[model samples]
Target: MAVRISKILLVASIGALLLLIALDNVFDYNTNYEIVSHVMSMDEVPRDSVISWRSITNPTLHKLLYGFIIFTEFAAAALCLAGAGKLWRERRAEAVRFNAAKNIAVAGLALGLGLYLFGFLGVGGEWFQMWRSATYNMQQAAFRFIGSIGLVLLFVHQRDD
Candidate 1:
C-alpha cells in the first residue's frame, strides 16, 4: 500500500512539474522562445562548422516548433494527472487491478521521456548543435528531466503484487 501511494504521488508530482513548465512557457513566452530560437537557428554554433547548413533561420518554423513542444508538455501533464487519479482510486484494489491502473501513468512517463530524450537531446542537442551554445544549451536540464522521469517510470511500472 505504501509503495502504491508512493507511485501515485510520484506520478502526480511529475504531472505538476510538466503542467508548471507548460504554463511557464505560455506565460513567459519569450524567455524560452529565445532558447528554442537560438537552438534552431544554430547561430550560436561555430561559424565555420559545416552543420550550419542545417540551421533553421525561419521565425515561423521556430514558433511552430515551440508550440509543438508546449502542446506535448501539456498533453503529458494531463495524462499523468489522469493516471495518478486512476491509481488513487484503485489503490486498494487487488494487485491485478492496481497494476492495470498504471497504464496511463506509463504512457505519460513515456511521452515525457520521448520529449526530453528525442525532442530536446536528440534534435536540439545533436541535430541543431545546441550543445555548442553556451547561452542556449539545455542538454543538462534535459538530461536531468530524462533521468528523473525515467526512474519514476521504472518504479511505477513494477508489478503491484
Candidate 2:
C-alpha cells in the first residue's frame, strides 16, 4: 500500500512539474521562445563549426516547433495526472488491476523522456550543436529532466503485488 501511494505521488509530482513548465512557457513566452530560437538557429554555436549548415535560421519555424513542444508537454502532464488519479482509485484493487492502471503513467513518463532525450538532447543539443553554445546550451537541463522522468518511469513500472 505504501509503495502504491509512493508511486502515485511520484507520478503526480511529475505531472505537476510538467504542468508548471508548460504554464511557464505559455506565460513567459518570449523567454523560452528565445531559448528555442537560439537553439534552432544555432546562432551561438561556433561560427566555423561543420554543423553550422544544420542551423535553422527561420523565426517562423522556431515558433512552430516551440508550440509543438509546449503541446507535447501539456499532453504528457494531462496523461500523468490522469494516470495518478487512476492509480489512486485502484490502490486497493487486485494486483492485476493496479498494474494495468499504470499504463497511462508509463505513457506519460515515456513521452517526457522522449521529449527531453530526443527533442532537446538529440535535435537541439546534438543536431543543432546547442552544446557548443556558451549561452544557449540546454543539454544539462535536458539531461536532468530525462533522468527524473526516467527514474519515475522505472519506479512506476514495477508490478504491484
Estimate, for each residue in 75-155, the C-alpha lDDT of model 1 and write its tens digit: 999999999999999999999999999999999999998999999999999999998889999999999999989999999
lDDT of 2 by residue, 1-161 (tens): 99999999999999999999999999999998999999998888777977788888889999999999999999999999999999999999999999999999999989988999999999998899888889889899999999999999999998887
The prediction achieving the highest TM-score against the true structure is 1
Consecutive 10-residue window with the lowest summed lDDT within model 2: 44-53
Q: Please report, in order, the local distance difference test score of every candidate based on alpha carbons.
A: 0.96, 0.93
For all the candidates, what are their Cα RMSDs to the real structure? 0.7, 0.8
* Residue-level error in angstroms, candidate 2, position 101: 0.6
Best by lDDT: 1
Candidate 2 residue pairs in backbone clash: none
C-alpha lDDT of candidate 1 relative to the true structure? 0.96
The residue pairs found clashing in candidate 1 are: none
User: Which runs in model 1 stand beyond 4 Å of their true positions?
Assistant: none
Clashes of each: 0, 0
